[model samples]
Target chain A: MMQALVTCRGLTKVFGKGELAVHALDGVDLDIHRGDFATLAGPSGSGKTTLLNMIGALDKPTSGEVTIEGTPLSTMSKAALSELRLEKIGFIFQAYNLIPVLSALENVEFVLQLQHVGAAERRERATAALHEVGLAGMESRRPSAMSGGQQQRIAVARALVSRPSIVLADEPTANLDSTTTAELMELMSRLNRDNGITFVIGTHDPRVMAHSQRHIEMIDGKIESDTND
Target chain B: MNNFGILRTIAWRNLWRNPKRTLITLIVVTVGLWSILAFSMLLNAWAESSRQNALGLLIGQGQIHAAGYMDDPNIDHLMPPPDGALRDVLDSDGVAHWVARLQLPGVVQSEYKTLPITILGVDPAGEREISLVPDKIVEGRYLNGLDDDAVIIGANLAKRLKTTLGRRIILMSTGADGYLEEYSFDIVGIFDADQGFEDSYVFTGRSLLQEYMGLDDEIAQISFVLPDESGLPAMIDTLKAAAPDLDIRDWKQVSVMAAAMNSAMKSIIYIWLGIMIIMMSIGIINTQLMAVFERTQEFGLIRAIGLKPRMVLWLVTLESALLMAVGMVLGVILAVLTYFGFQGGLDLSGFSRAMEAIGSGQVLYPQFAPADFVIYPVLIWVIGVLVALWPAYRAQKISPVEAMRHAT
Candidate 1:
C-alpha cells in the first residue's frame, strides 16, 4: 500500500542503428515505492547503469517512458529535467566526482546553492551533511587532498545535503578499499533506516546487494530476477 | 552565495588551475593592447608635429589676404593694415598672435648668381610669435626693427648666392608704380630650414620694404594664430564679417598637404587597431577553446549535478571576460608607463632630413588621449567576450552522460 515513487513501463534505450546498434536497455518494466532501498546488480553492459541514467533524468529512453511520482519524464524540457534533478533527485557517480576547484564543504553546498537556498541555511545544511558523513573537521580540504574513501564520502555529503526525494548512486564503492566500503555501506543503511529516504543503487557487488532490502539482477539489457530479502 | 557568486568563484579558481596557460594568454592580451595604444600615441604625436611644423613655418592657424592676393602676390593685390572692426576681433582673447607681412614676388642677385624668390616684409617683434624662421636663424641675428635695412636670407640661398652675414645683395620687385625697381641691402642673418623652404623665401624689415617699394602702409597678408584650433572656424567667421572684402581661410584650406596628412594618420590608426584586434582575437579564441576542451568532463559533471547548459555557457564566458579585463588593466598600466618614459619627447633628430621633408620637427612628443583609453579597452573587452562565445557554446552542449566516460 506504499506510494510508488517511480514507475518504468517497457523502457528501452538503443545506442546506435542497423547492424551496429546496441540495446543498452530493452523493455525494463519496474516499480520502486517510497522508502525502498533497492539495488540493481549486474555485470558490465547489462543495462543497470543505463537504467539508473533513465531514472535520474540524465538521459531519455528511446522507447516507452519513466515516470517519477506519476509525472512522465519524457514530457519535460531539458530545463525542466535539470530543475527536477536539482530539486527532486540526487546523484552519486562512480568516479567520486566532486568539483575539483571547490573544497569539501563548498562541494556539499553546491546543490543547495543551485536551488537558490539562503546562504545561511545552505551553509548550515552542508555542514550538517558533512558531519553526518563523518567528515566534520575536513570541510576546507579539497578533493585532490583527500583519499578515495574521503572523497566519495564528500560526494555522498553533496548528494544528501539538499534532502532530495530519491538518491541514485552508481558504483558508489567501486573505488574504495574493503574497510572503506564496509563503512560506506553501514552509513548508507543507517541513512535509509533513520531518514526514510529512498535509494536506488546500481552495482555488481554482491556485498552491496546483501545490504539492500530488494535485489534486482539484470543481464543483457533484461532483468533476470527481482526479489525481496 | 547565489548561483552567479559560486560560478564566479569557480571561474576565478579554475583560471589558475593551469597557471602556465593562463599566464601565456594574459601576456598575449597585454602585449597586444600595449602595442595598439603605443602605436596610436606615436602616430598622434607625429601628426601633431607635422601640423605645427607646417603652420609655424609661415601660416598661422589662419590667414587674411586681399581678395586676389593668394592668386597674385604682386603689389597690385595689396591691402591696408588691420584697423577698426578687423583689428578689434584680431585683438580678442581667442587670437594668440597676429602678424602682418608685406609678401611679394621679387628677384635677388648675389655677386655670383641671381634667382627669383618670395620676399616677406616682417616686423621683428611680431614675427617672433608667428614664424619659425626667426628662431631658426643659424648665423648673425634676426631683423632689429621695422626700420632695420638689413635683410635675412635662407642658408640654402646664402650658399647659392655665395653670400654670408654682412654681405650686400640686390633686391628687385615691382614697386607701387607698376615698374621694376631695385635696391641694395645687407644680409644680416641666414636661417636654416628645409631645403625647399630655404630656397624659396627672403625676409626684411616691414617698414624698410614698404618705403623701398613706394608703399606707405599697405600690407599683403595678415596671418593669425588661435589658442586652440577648434576656435579657428568661429574666428574665421568673425574676421570675414569684419573685413568682408578680404579672404579668410583656416590652415587646412591654406595647406592641402597638412589636411591630407591629418586624414591619412586617422586611417593608419584604424588599420593598426584592426590588426591588433585580429591578433588578440586569435589568441583569445585559442585559449578559450583549449580550456573548454580540457574541462569537458568537468562540464559534464556540473551539468549532471543540475546546472543548465546556459549557466555553463555563462560561466565559461565569465572566465574569459575576467581574463581579458585583467590583461587590459595591466596593458593600460604598461602603456601609461611607456608614455611617461618618453615624456621629455622622443628625439628623431637623427632622421632630421626625413622629418623635415614631411614638415615635422626633430623631436616628436607622444600624447595620451583620454578617449582612446575608453574606446580601445571597452572595444577590446567586448570583442574578446564575443570571440569567447564559441568556446562557451561548445561547453554548453556537453552531455551529462559524458561524465560517465573516462576523462583525459
Candidate 2:
C-alpha cells in the first residue's frame, strides 16, 4: 500500500457573495498517494483546476482542508506556504512558463538559487535535469530560441530540478500537437514509473487520462467517478 | 550567483529589454541633475561677484565712523584721528587693510560747469590697498600725497564739470568753525568707474583737505577691507573693542540692498531645484509604473516560484536604483564639463545695463563650493531611490494567480 502524499477532505471554493456567488469548488474529497500518476479529468468550468490550485497552495479553499504530507495548508502562513512550494512541490504550466530574460539553465536553477543551494551543486543538478528531459546541449539557450516542444521540456526540467515530491501540471499538454503531446505524456509517465515521483495533472483530454494510473472525473465541482468506478 | 545576484541580473536585463524607454527616463534624470549642478555653480559665482562688487565700490567689508557721522556727514560731525590704542588695533592682523578718509558733501566748480559730489579726501598710499578706484585709472594718474593737493575725479564727473587732467577745480565745503571754506586743486586723475560711481564722487588729498578746512588731522572715517569676508564678525568685534567711542558698521548694514539680493538669489536657487526634482520624480514614477505593467506576468511568475511580495518590491526598487545610478553618473560628468566649459565666465555683456542696475559685473563665472560636490550626489541618489518606491509597491501587491492568466 502506497502512503498518502496529499489528502483533501470536503474542499469548497466560492467566488462572489450571496445571490450572486459561485461555487467554483464544492465538497471535493480525494486522496493522491505516493507513486500514483493521477489525472483530474473534467469539462470546462468544472473544479479540476481549482482543486489542483488548492493542492498547490496557489489558492485557498472556502471551507475545507488540503493536507500535504500531514501539514494542513490552513495553518501555514503565506511565507511558509511559499517555502513549502519551493521545497515540496513543483509546477508545470500549460503555456510553457519560463523567464524570458534567463537562459534555460538559469531558469531551471532559479528555484534552487532561491533555496540557497550552492552554485556548483545547483548547476550540476540543473544540468542533469535538462539532460533527463532530452535537452542535453540546449542548456544555454533562452526560451524564445527553442521550439514549443523544447520550451515545454525546459519547463519540465525546471519543475524536476527542484526535486519536489509532486509536480502539479495544469493542462500541460493543452498547447502541444498530437506528436509532441504523446512524447510529453510518455516522458512524464516514465518519470513517474522510474522515479516514483507523484504527478497530479488537470485536463479534459481522454489521451491524458489514458496515461494516468488514477482517473478522477469531475463535473460542476463534484467528483462524478474515480478509479473505484 | 546568489539570490541578490539573481535579482540584479533580472533587473539589469529587464532594464535593457526596452532600451528606448529606459534611455528616455535616464535622460530625464541626467538632464535634471546636470541642470541643477550647472545652474548652482553659475548662481554661486554671480552671488560672489555681487558681494565683491558691494564691498569694493565704496563700502569696504566694514567701516569706522565718528559717533554721529553715518547719520550726518559734515564738518561738525568729524572725529579726531585714531589714537595710539585705536591705531594699534586697526593695524592688527584682523584688519587686512585700512584707509582713513575725510569724506564730506561738497561742490566742485570747473571753468564751464558746477556739480554736487561727495568729496573724499584720501591718503593715496593707504587708499590703493583698500579701493579698486585707485587702480581703475584709465585717463590720468591716481592721487599722489596729502601735500600733493592733486584731485582725482571720476571720468563722468570730469565730463559733467567740463574738466580734464591738469584742469583747475574749486572745492567748497564747511570748515570746523561752521564757516564756508574753499580751495583750488588740479585734477590729476580721472577714473572710469561703474555707471553710478563715475558721476557721484571725487577724490583728493586727506591732509590737504584738512588744511583747507582748518582742522589739524581730524578725519571723518576709516574704512577697512579684509582678505575674506568670512572673518568679518570676529574682526568687527575686535575693532569695536579698540574704538569704543566710534561707530562701526559691516558691509551688510552699509549696503542693505546687496545683502537682501544675496539672500533672495539663494532662496530662488533652492526653490528652482525643488521644482526640478519634483518633476523628475514624477517622470520616474510614470516610467517605472509602465515598466511594471508590461512585466506583470514576469512578476507573477516569480511570485509563484516562491519569491515573496516584499522581494518583488525589492526587485523593482533595485531596477529603479540601477536606472538612477546610470543617470547620475552621466549627469555628474556633464555637470563637471559644463562648469569647466564656463570657467572663464559666461559672457552676459548683452545684459550689461541690467547687470549694472543690480551693481553686478557683465560676466558671470560659474563656481562650486567643496560641499556642493559631496552633498549633491548623495542627496540626488537617495531621493531618487526613495521616489522609486511607488512603483515597487505596486509591483509587490500583484497576486501570484495572475501568472496562470498571463502565462505567456
Candidate 3:
C-alpha cells in the first residue's frame, strides 16, 4: 500500500449561516496516494471545486481535518501554510493566470523565486520546465503575445518548475478547444507518469474524466460515487 | 528573491508604465518648488541689498554719541571732538574710517526758494570713508578741503531751494542755546544717495558747523566704518568699552525700519511656504490615491504570490519617493538657473524711481541662503512621503481574494 500523500477525514465546508446558510460541502472522506492522477467531476454548484481548494490549502474546511504528508493544515500558521503552498503545492486555474506584464520565462520563474531559489538555479530550472512543456523558443514572449494554448502551457511550466508534491487544478481546460484540451491532458498525464507527481483536477468535462486514472463524481454538495478506471 | 529588491524593481517599472501621467505630476511638483525658490531668493536679495545701501548711505558700521544723544539728539548732548586716544582705539579695533558729525534741523534759503532740511556737519576726508558721498554726487563735486563755510546740498533739497553748486545759501537754525541763529554756507556739491530721505540732506564741514553753532570743538556723533559688515557687532562692543560715556549704535539700531521690513519679508516667505506645502500635499495625495486605485489588482496578484501587506505599502512609498526625487531635481535645476539669471544683473530701469523710493535702484538681483536650497527640497520630499501614507494604508487593507476577484 503506497502512503497517502493527502488525507481528508469527514471534510465539510459551509457558506453563510442560519437561515441563509448553504452547505457547499458535506461530510466527505478521501485519501490520495503519491503519484495518483485523479479527477473530481460534478455539475455547476457541486462541491468538487471546494474540496480541491481545501486540499490545496486555499480554503479551510468547516469540520474535518486535512493533512498533506502528515502535517495537518489546521495546525499550521498563515505564514507556514503559505510556505507549504510555495514549496510543496502548485495550482493551475481555468483562466491561465499568468502575469500579463511578465515574459513566459519570468512567469515560470516567479514560483521558483517565491520558493527562495537562487537566480541562476531558478532560471535553469524554469528554462527546463518551459522546454518540457514545449515552450522552449517562446520564453521572451508575453502572455498577450501568445495563443491560448501557449499561455496555458506557460502556466503548466510555472506549476512544474518547482517540482511540487501535488498540483491542484480547477477547470484548467474549460476555455480550450477539444484538440488543445486533448493535447494539454496528454502533456499533464505524461508529466504525472514520468515524474510521479500527484494531480487533483476538478472539472465537469467528459474528456478530463476519460483521461483521468480515477474519477470521483459529486452532486450538489456531496460525493455521489468514486470509481477507478 | 529579497522582498525589498523585488518591490523596488516593480516600483521603478510601475512609474514608467503611465509615462504621461507621471510626467505631468512631476511637472506640477517641480513648478511649485521652483516658484517658491525663485520668490524666496528674490525677496532675500532685495531685502539684503536694501539693508546694505541704507547702512552705507545713512548709517555707518556703528555710531557713537553722548549717553542720551539718540533718544533726543539735541545739540546740548554733543561731545567734544575725538582726540588721539580715540584714534588709537579706532585703529586697534580695525576701524577702516571714522567721521565726526553734527546733525541738526534747519531751514535753507536760496535765491528763489526756501525749504526745511536736516543739516549734517562732516569732515570731508573722514566722511568719504564711511559714506557714499563721493559716488553719489549727481550734479557737482563732493567736499575737497574744508573751506571755512562750504556746504553740500542734496539733489532734492537743492531743487526745492532753487540752488546749484558753488552758490551761497542762508541756513537758519537754533544754536546749542535756545536762541535762533543764522549762518551762510557756500554750496560746494549736490549729492543724490538714491534714497528720498538722503536726497533731501544738507552736508557741510564739521569746523564750519562748529563756528556757526558757537561750539568750538564739540561733536555730535562719531561714526566708524569696518571692512566687513559682519564685524560691526564686535566693533560696537569695542567702541562701547573705549568710550563709556558715549552710546554705541550699530547699523541695525540706526535703521529700525530695515529690521521691520526684514521681519515682514520673512513672514511673507513663511506664508508662501505654508501655501505651497498644502497645495503640493493635495496634489501628491491625489496622485497617490489614483495610483493605488489603478494598481489594486496588480497588488493583489503580487500579494497572492506571497508578498506581505507591508511590502505593498513599501512599494507605494518608494514610488512616491522616486517621483518626488525626480521633481526635486528638476525644480532645483530650474531655481538655480533662474537665480543666476537674475543675479547676473537684471535691469529695473522702468521701476528705478519706485526702487529708489524704497532705497533700491536700477537693478534687482536674486539670492538664496545655502540652507534654504538644501533644507527646502528635503522638506518637500518628506511632505511627499507623508502624503503617500493614506494611499499606502488603503493598499495595505486590500484583501488579496477580493482584489483578485474584482480585477481593478
Model 2, which residues run further than 4 Å from truth?
A1-3, B67-78, B92-94, B105-118, B138-141, B147-190, B196-200, B211-214, B227-234, B248-250, B347-351
Candidate number with greatest TM-score: 1
Assign candidate 3 its CAPRI class: acceptable
Residue A6, model 3: lDDT of: 94
| Candidate 3 lDDT, B17-111, residue by residue in tens | 77887888888889978988888897787787787777777577678888888888777788887766666778764787888888877888888
Which 10-residue window of candidate 3 chain A scores lowest in summed lDDT? Answer: A93-102
lDDT of 1 by residue, B1-408 (tens): 789999999999999999998999899899988888998898889999988888898988899999998887789999999999999999989899999999989999999999999998998999898888889999999999998898999999999999899999999999999889899999999999888889999999999999999999999999999888887889999999999999899999888888899999989989988888898889888988999888888888889889998999999999999999999999999999989998899999999989988778999999789788779989999999999999999999988886566541
TM-score of chain B of each: 0.89, 0.86, 0.91
What's the distance in Å from true for residue A115, model 1? 0.8
Model 3 misplacement above 4 A:
A1-85, A93-96, A99-101, A111-115, A162-165, A170-183, A201-211, A214-229, B83-86, B105-117, B144-174, B182-200, B339-343
Check candidate 3 and list the clashing pairs.
none
- The lDDT values for all models are 0.90, 0.86, 0.80
What is candidate 3's lDDT per residue for A131-223, written digit by digit as tens?
Answer: 999999999998989888888888888888878888888788888999999999999999999999889999999998888998989897788
Clash list (residue pairs), candidate 2:
none
Q: Fraction of native Cα contacts kept in each candidate?
A: 0.60, 0.61, 0.10
Model 2 chain B poorest ten-residue lDDT run: B399-408
Local error of candidate 2 at B192, Å? 4.0
